[model samples]
Target: MKRKEKFENRKTVRKTECRRSRNLGSCPAAEVSKLQKTVNSFAYTLEKAHFLDYVQYASNEKRIFRRAFLTGLLRGFGTAVGVTVLGAVIIYLFQALAKSNLPYIADFISDIIDIIEKTRK
Candidate 1:
């Protein structure tokens, strides 16, 4: 009979232990600490992630691209300047020739007018 009583007491203790464990899930302290640890770990990893490395890599790529862009722009500008200088020289030579050949001025003017009219048409 005493052995049966001991077994019943042990069963009661086991039942209470199971109920306590289930209630722990609803406990405020346990829930708060669980959430706190998760938040802390997320914040730590976020702080550790490197952003400067990405910025430096982007800046280096931009610098290389910008350098190439500037080089191409300067080359195009130089070619345009050379063409303009050649055109100016040609125009100056023709003007000089026209001054010395007064009779040709009328023909030159007629040719200029025809080119303008053709381009307009």
Candidate 2:
């Protein structure tokens, strides 16, 4: 019975020592510090990548906006010029038609004047 009790106590001591050693072996101070630094740097790198992507997206948007603005400006200018030319042409044709009918209008007026004179006499 004495030997069995002694053997049991020795086994308990060995188990405690093994547990402590295992806990110490899992994470040393140097490795724990290195892991913390790695985690921080990983987070920083992701932030940088996101910032760069945002910059690129903004640049592309700016370029597209400028192109749209320029295109709208040119189209507006062209429309203005085309409308002005079309208005001028319509006015010129109306004036030409009036001039061409003037001679007929004058002859009708002269015939009316002659008839009135003959009727008075």
Candidate 3:
């Protein structure tokens, strides 16, 4: 049998067994109590996790947009500063290499530095 069919058959069998065992004909109250307990547990979990606070925050469009804008602005500024520092470090390394005894590498780095200087003019 299909998986879903098997699951449904088992569920039906359990319901019948439960009714027989409890001697409850319709078992409406028992089902309602079970549902209520499940709902209460879910609500308690949500409350404990502060889900309502997050929902309230998300419901405010202006606050969400403002937070997003500030986050993006900080990220962009951080990226710019990081890149500048990294570039400076790389140039310093190149300068050190230019001062070293390796003639070919020194010449190549010097040429690159000259090109960069020319670009600023």
Among these predictions, the greatest TM-score belongs to: 3
- Stretches of model 3 off by over 4 angstroms after superposition: 1-41
lDDT of 1 by residue, 1-121 (tens): 6999999998778656655776555445655587679999987776687556656767798787998999999999999999999976866666566557568685795576557558779
lDDT of 2 by residue, 1-121 (tens): 6999999998778656655675645555665577679999998998978977767768898787998999999999999999999966855555565456577764565555556558779
Q: Where's the lowest-lDDT run of ten residues in candidate 3?
A: 19-28
The lowest-lDDT stretch of 10 consecutive residues in candidate 2 is 90-99
lDDT of 1: 0.74
In candidate 2, how many Å is residue 10 off? 68
Cα-lDDT of candidate 3: 0.88
TM-score of each: 0.35, 0.36, 0.68
